[model samples]
Target: MGVLSTFLVSWLGKDAMAGVGLADSFNMVIMAFFAAIDLGTTVVVAFSLGKRDRRRARVATRQSLVIMTLFAVLLATLIHHFGEQIIDFVAGDATTEVKALALTYLELTVLSYPAAAITLIGSGALRGAGNTKIPLLINGSLNILNIIISGILIYGLFSWSGLGWV
Candidate 1:
């Protein structure tokens, strides 16, 4: 999604793309929580299943789900609150215009962190359940949705003004 957005926003011009790409990099860092949850959940669940200990697997999965969800929500709130500073901090020596545009983009996108986390956690949980198909299907749907929404907001379908400045 970040790569696609880097290209899509390129139509906005170079500074726009640079800012967004930088912010995307930060977003990826935040998303590392998903991988942590997935890895921890997978290890515990897989270990339990290997030992044929259904109760342990179930307990670990439940505990991990709660902790990951809380962490995701907290992270999303932090991003929404301080996302501009984060953008600026990560943008290095980028021009002010680029930083402003990136802040605007972040404003439109910061709330999505929690939703993405839910999807990520769902994928992890499903993996723990030993069904890879569901996670793949869910992630596919997420990618398609990201494209559709970003297209609408970035390109302004139906003559509505796009989120980005033209």
Candidate 2:
């Protein structure tokens, strides 16, 4: 996303790139929360698996699911509701169009957090089972999909192509 933003900014203008950067930064902050949750989940799952307690393992999985779901929903809601305000706050003294674009991107991207949470929990569980290959494949696939989606959506290569100045 950063590369795309830089290219767009260079091709179009600072306002466009700055808007993209703001949106990306906002997304990164939200993802950081998920990262912490993921790390905790991984540790807990590993501990349960190490103890050889199937029941506890299952419970750990459920607890992570519940926690991640609530967190993702709350965070998404906050981002969606205050998204414009956040854009404005970050892009102070910037162009109105840039702020608008940044808010739009943020609102649209926040929906992905729930799925991301699920993925993180699932990967954590798999890793706990000592099945590193599956988790690696899943993460790699996700990265590839992310690259394709980002290119298509953010770069306006698909339906959104006409939306940006680029």
Candidate 3:
């Protein structure tokens, strides 16, 4: 989804594409951390359930979601507060326009971290419970939706002249 978003942004111009690409680099790192945490949750839940311990499995899932969500919120807040500095540091030697655009993208995207963590963690829990189909469907649908929405946002529902497709 991040890569697809960058591709869509690329249509806007070179600077926009560069900015989104830079921001996405940082986003990927953050998401990799969440993926690691999700892997742990999946292992714990799978192990607990394998032992036929429903209670422990349930507790583990609940605690994992709560802790991860809280952590994501705190991380997002700090990133949002310091986004400019962070982008500046990461975007060294980039043009001012590119850096500014990257900062704005990062700031906006930080707000979604908590939701992203919840989705990743919840899907992982489901996978641990032996329901892999749901996670597959969820992720697939989200990617499709992201593409559609990004297109509409970038190009609008119709051409600006209102007489042809964008």
Could you estimate the TM-score for every candidate?
0.89, 0.83, 0.92
Best by TM-score: 3
Q: Write the per-residue lDDT of candidate 1 for residues 1-166, one digit (tens) a residue.
A: 7788898989888988987887778877877867777777877887888899999988888887777778877877787788778877888888898888777776666678767767776677668768799999989988998888888888887878777732
- Candidate 2 total steric clashes: 1
Ranking by lDDT: 3, 1, 2
- Sorted on TM-score, highest at the top, how do the candidates line up? 3, 1, 2
Look at candidate 1 and give me any clashing residue pairs. Answer: none
Alpha carbon lDDT of each predicted model: 0.79, 0.76, 0.85
Show model 1 residue runs off by greater than 4 Å.
none
Worst 10 residues of 1 by lDDT: 105-114
The candidate, 1 or 3, that scores higher on lDDT is 3
Candidate 1 or 2, higher TM-score? 1
Residue 3, candidate 1: C-alpha displacement in angstroms:
0.3
- The numbered model that scores best in lDDT is 3
Summarize candidate 2's per-residue lDDT along 33-132 as a digit string, tens digits: 7877777777877898898887888888889888898889898999888887888887788789888877876787788889888888888877876778
Instruction: Provide the RMSD of all predictions against the true structure, rounded to 1 decimal.
Output: 2.0, 2.8, 3.4
